[model samples]
Target chain A: MDFLTVIQLLDSTVRLATPLLLACLAGLFSERAGIFDIGLEGKMLAAAFFSAAVAALTGSVWIGLLAGIGASVALSLLHGLASITFRGNQLISGVAINFLAAGLTVLIAQDWFSQGGRTPSLMGGARFEPITLPFADALADVPVVGPVYAELISGHSVLVYLAFLTVPVTWWVLFRTRFGLRLRAVGENPAAVDTAGVSVIGLRYAAVVICGVLCGIAGAYLSTALQAGFVKDMSAGRGFIALAALIFAKWRPWHALYATLLFGLFGALETRQDVITAVIGIKVQGQVLGALPYVMTVIILAGFVGKAIPPRAGGEPYVKER
Target chain B: MDVVPKWAEVILVPLISLMLAAILSALVILAIGEDPVAAVNLMITGALGSTYGWGYTLYYATNFLFTGLAVSVAFHAGLFNIGGEGQAMLGGLGVALACLLVPWPHWTIALLAATVAAGLFGAAWAAIPAFLQARRGSHIVITTIMFNFIAAAVLNYVLVNLMRPAGSMDPATARFPEAVHLPTLHDILGVVGIEFSKSAPANVTFLIAILACVLVWLLLWRTWLGYEIRSYGKSESAAKYAGISPFAITMIAMLISGGLAGMMAINNVMGEAERLVLNAVEGAGFIGIAVALMGRNHPFGVFLAAILFGFLYQGGAELALWTSIPRELIVVIQALIILFTGALDNMVRMPLERLFLMIRRGNA
Candidate 1:
């Protein structure tokens, strides 16, 4: 492809990667504090449904985004309560939340909207709009660099930028902030953190809540930014993909961005396999090519990966001996 | 014995959760301007009344039993295996291929080969996670969940590309030749002139599932291997001290569990549909977790829990026909059941047994 085309792909690649990156970071924060947080998918699904519904109803994308976040966080908190406080099975609880969200969303969508999923299409104001900064517009007139600035870096939803920005912010909070240290300490060794005069329960709860908030933004971005509105199972295993990104990134915030972007690249490749096949002159069913990302991901995770050490008591419930 | 009421702990939480979920579901219906009472009542009448619905529900319950057994076995070993879906898919593929492609002189032999193939594939799929967990200390939960997605995606790819038959939105294989479909009990129902009006899929698979349940119970309670598994599950460190290899036992337990799931696929494919099909067993494998949990990891309990889910599966949709709501509400209820069963551990049988023993001794 020409420079302009390559630049275009680069910009779109980042935009596509943002949702997965946001989600992976969301998972990273919670899991780093030693919670499995399996409900990320459910949270996303819930947010997607709510955001779509509210966006279409009130005709305000911003309000819809807030509503979506609220819905996801509520479900996330429900999962947190069951998994963290009740010390329930993290995997099962997460799966349950997902199931509930899936069923409830569909049921409600059908009830109110009367569509077999595929929420009513959004209008101009009800949808998240891409913004090209004034500088981006000016830079678009330059030669090769113009195409790069115009196509790749500009005219994307604002969330895309915010998602990238969160990486540095996350690193700061997780490594430098006291709350981050306490959260990390709880995951590594609740006993020591407890002895250090921090209430491990309180710290972990805060961490989980933070996870819910990030998951909310990720979900809102999914419905409003990534796609126009929610469709049934629109999350389409992205939550699990984000989990994969978490492991791939080793739960580091900055690394998560790269890991998620890599997955997104694979995703883009899979989607653009038609273009790939045209260029290469190969023949294969589109579905097989599409399945490549998941297959390759599993292979990478299962085979070459060295080891993933979960937080010392990540899935265990803390029962104070005293 | 301590004065704690027997069966209270074993039963209360699940019962409460079931009632609460049902009530909440009813409220949802009410909010949606639907009559919950009439809808549920129609579902009950339809499921239990006609022979066909009864048969379909029983067939589904059998699926639940196998999947639930698979999950429960791992749970008893202190392993949470979310790979039942993948394992079951592999098992379904195995049975379908065996029944559809294998050349067998006799139908009975063909069925046997298909069932074995299904069981073997299921075991193999499960063995991947088991082996990883045993050898590398990998987290089975995440690995299994990840594989579940891969399995579905791969299965879809294979079915649509390689195995799809002509003129079908459903990516299913050629129907298994007549030799494979299990004989329905409706034949007997007719012989006695006690017509099972509307015919059901009541066949020998139910008997096989029960037999498997009995065998699982025997193995769990009466065998040295079972003892080792239980001990290992209760405390891996202690199990190691007692000379059992956690890796070996875990692999064996998970394989067996997965094999049982495979057996469920046999009933679903060879015994019923008689073809390798996409969505053949549906999400029964995943639903099995709820079944196994509700049964509190007991053979008999699983049987009943499977029936409950079976009823929901049949009724959840049937109610939809009579109401505007889709039958998938059953899945919602199923999700609620799984959530409650997982969160409240005391409903499980073994712990209840221990609590009972403690209570009895304290009273004495």
Candidate 2:
């Protein structure tokens, strides 16, 4: 209700939306290349664990980011091997990867840390410190613009900025680049791309790898930047929520930013149930707010509000004609 | 005309996949600095060495049987119902309502009513997704996943606000009436002078689960609708050309799947806990996917896979209680099995097919 409260909510919204935006963009890349990845959650969880674990061990967040990306890329390659090379069911492969990540992360975490499937809480340089933007302190006294610039926009971890920045980069790469054209062609009609002398498998694999990198950054952001350390099931369905956001955005990059931000707002509202109850003049359950994103996704998917059509060749393995 | 023998297709492939999964699980155990042999020994003895363990195993297997059959029925119709967890949770709500609202004079009647209520609730929960998939071209997988979360939220609301007994802090329904308690395996076996574990939760629902398996086999293989479902699954365009209705098959298959998944609540909620609680289904709905995958979507295969998982579950619990191996090892194994058998089928099948062709050529 108050301006400060609204700013604070928006700040948390930006923080929460970072992972979703990253993962949504990740899904956009993979799905646009004809590979449906439901395992985004699993990949994020694995990256979250490894990033935190390595960060705790080596005390370097940069090295941890690399490890996180490496973990995600490894899983992505496995998915590629199953869905692309072997021509297996993409959804089943995604499901397997998800289960594998879910189990292995906790299993290994318990084995190493013995903290009941949690890594040691990160501190100092091992975590991503908040970077206050230039003039944030100086402009604090100015009215609406100053508070918005200083309190809401500034003081987020570096990943938050990167996540937002990647949106434009993704839009440029997807719409303007030759590789992007070929990737889109592969997802829409792999045969046309193949006939044009591009290797469908290679292009798709590239897209999948890119997806892995983005998802890895998202996971590292969760454990290292957002929270202090990895917790069991810490991704906590964020992957699926990201998938929903991807659908809600209709697999577009810029739209993904808005979709993720909206979902993030729902998350912020869930955390601020008291504020919601005050505004509504009646008790509103956090569970209802928590379920809002998923419900909205289903409505979008069912084409109630608008159609969210996926790539034409999405979830289908490409087999070259002899 | 098949390259591989029927026996090999049905038995050998899964056997080899199971072996691969076992080897990978063994390596995982070794990586954890634990002896795989001792762990296996402990699992075997803990799960099958005594009636107490068997009770727990059978109880778990019963839950899997319903959920696994749920997945299998949908798999036959080419519709994946991954919302089994949500459906089962709603099913628990159904069972709770049926048991709590009516003062049933007998457990038999209560069981019948609860089964119907559970199935209806599960089917109702699944209906929206099924409708969207059938009519609107929405992906069933995504829609079903969304439904699972919604179902969880709905169940949470119901338990916390509506069902929770006054003054009780826990978000769970009040206990069902004593008269509605189903007979446990101990009580049933005791009548025949056979010893069984009294503390174990395995109950008459196990028999019901067995019966459901038989009924599902009959429905899929012996009925006209099953033929239509299989045909539709094999080739939708061909089925349509042959006059089979795609919408009808999808709707029917999903309803059956959701109903079967919902029936799992009878075993867990009514027979075991006798109270509806948050996360009552736990992860059994997801486990159903693994079971159905390993079982190759066959009723008989589902029965065996359910028992195997049941063993793993009970054994894992014992392992967690006895050692540092943590219970999540079973989940890893389950993942490996799904990977090998479902996703990476060609990884095994291609080599096996080549070997079979070579053997046949040599024989010629």
Candidate 3:
């Protein structure tokens, strides 16, 4: 492929990877703290709808972002209430959250906007605009690195950069901070952490809340930044993909970045299925191409790839006496 | 040790949870600028009022029964098989292939062949995930969820490119031969001198679902294999120690689950649509999860839950057709029911447990 084509593919990869990265990081926090949250999809959907609805109404992306976060956090707390406080099945609660979000988003959208379960398309300040980095124009005509620097690295929305920045921040917070130590400990051995005088439930709640915030940003990035408004089930299966990436990454932040980027590359390639088939001189159907990520994850999880071990206490609610 | 009576534990908790979910759903209706009482009245009248309504409700219930049984079977083996959606999709393909490829003399012969075909197809789809979970230690939940998406893509491709009749604009297969068509509920009821609606979709498959429930009850309670499966579910390590093969139980349970899920196609495809459509499975596979949960993983309970969900579905359709309440809200209502009965169950149970304990102590 030409350098320009390569740069474009890389650009597409970046755009596609942003939401996955944010959601992956969200999963990282929740799972690391011992709460297995499969409702990342639900939370993202809720955020996407609320963000788009608020953005279109108020014409301010910032306020829309906050509303998105609030909606996501509210659902996250509900998950916590069911799984943590009530000691219910985590997976079932997650599934319920997903259903609630799918239905609530459309129901509210239809009620408020009367637009067939879709928010009005945002314009101007209501949507995220791409920012051109300094020297991008000046270096546009330079040698091989110029296009790479200008097209591939520059001209992304603020959330794209923030998503990338989260990897290192997450690594530091999960490895270096006192809170991180307790969070990790709680996942691995909540009894030990509790014996060490830490409040296990409190730490888990914090992790879930952080997860909600990150998922909020991911959803906002989709509706406000990627598209102008929310559509029903628009988050689609990306939240599940993020969970797969979380497992594929072995529950680490740096690995999440790599895994999400890889998945993003798969998504980018999915859009170019015919091109790939033509270039490779092979017969590949779009449906088969679209199923690559899922197929690959199953293969990996089936021990074709390396082992993936989740936290020991994950999926189990903390019981003090037990 | 059992402060709450078994009847209350089995029946009252779920009933109360259902009431709670109903109250919350009514509030949501009120919030949407609709009269909750009217909506409730409409739903009852729409889902259960007449022979036609009952026909549609029972048709939907038939689909749920299959999927619900699928989930409950897996639940008994302690496997959370969420791939019912995918399994049912493949089953649709099985039904289509059976009806399209062969010239069966009658519906009975065709039904038998399709049932076997669908069962095998669904079981094959589930085998990989079950094997991975049992042998490779991969989590079945994630794998099954992924398979659901893959199943959709597969069904979409088949319907668009393979199944569609020549020059047809729609992405659906041609109608199945009339010989393969199952008898409708109206026909069977008429033979028995009972009046019924002619246009309702409920068919012989509803009877098949009831038969399945009885069979499942027998398999779970009266068989040694059922004992093995249940013991393994209760404690895998203990089962291992007792010489019950984990791999065998996992595979058997999942195969049965997938087969049950696949049988839903007999009702949806052969009975109602009479042709394979791209989204024939719709979201009934996911709805099965809620059904299994509300049913408490029992066959009879699943039957009751399926009927309840069927009511919600038909009533929701009526609301969508007549009122401004969108169909999507029904999903939210279903989710709330699942949340209360499945996940937030302890919120009600804990308080009731405490109350029962206090009563017992006072008596003591």
**B68 in model 3: Cα distance from truth in Å?**
0.6
Clash count, predicted structure 2: 0
Q: Is the docking of candidate 2 incorrect, acceptable, medium or high quality?
A: high
**Candidate 2 chain A lowest-lDDT run of ten:** A271-280
Q: How much native contact recovery, as a fraction, does model 1 achieve?
A: 0.47
Tell me how each candidate scores on DockQ against the true complex.
0.54, 0.86, 0.86
lDDT of 2 by residue, A64-94 (tens): 9999999999999999999999999899889
C-alpha root-mean-square deviation, candidate 1: 3.1
Q: Is candidate 1 or candidate 2 better by lDDT?
A: 2
Among all windows of ten consecutive residues in candidate 3 chain B, which has the lowest summed lDDT?
A: B1-10
| Candidate 3 residue runs with Cα over 4 Å from true position | none
Better of 1 and 3 by lDDT: 3
Model 3: CAPRI class? high
lDDT of 3 at B230: 92
Candidate number achieving the greatest lDDT relative to the actual structure: 2
Q: Can you write out model 3's per-residue Cα lDDT over B40-62, one digit (the tens) per residue?
A: 89989999999999999999999
Q: Candidate 1 falls in which docking quality class?
A: medium
lDDT of 1 by residue, B115-231 (tens): 788889889888888887887676788778766776777778878877878787788778877766676667556677876644566666877788889999999999999999899
- In candidate 1, position A137 carries an lDDT of 79
Q: Which portions of model 1 show Cα errors greater than 4 Å?
A: A278-303, B1-6, B165-170, B191-193, B197-202, B344-364
The best candidate in terms of TM-score: 2
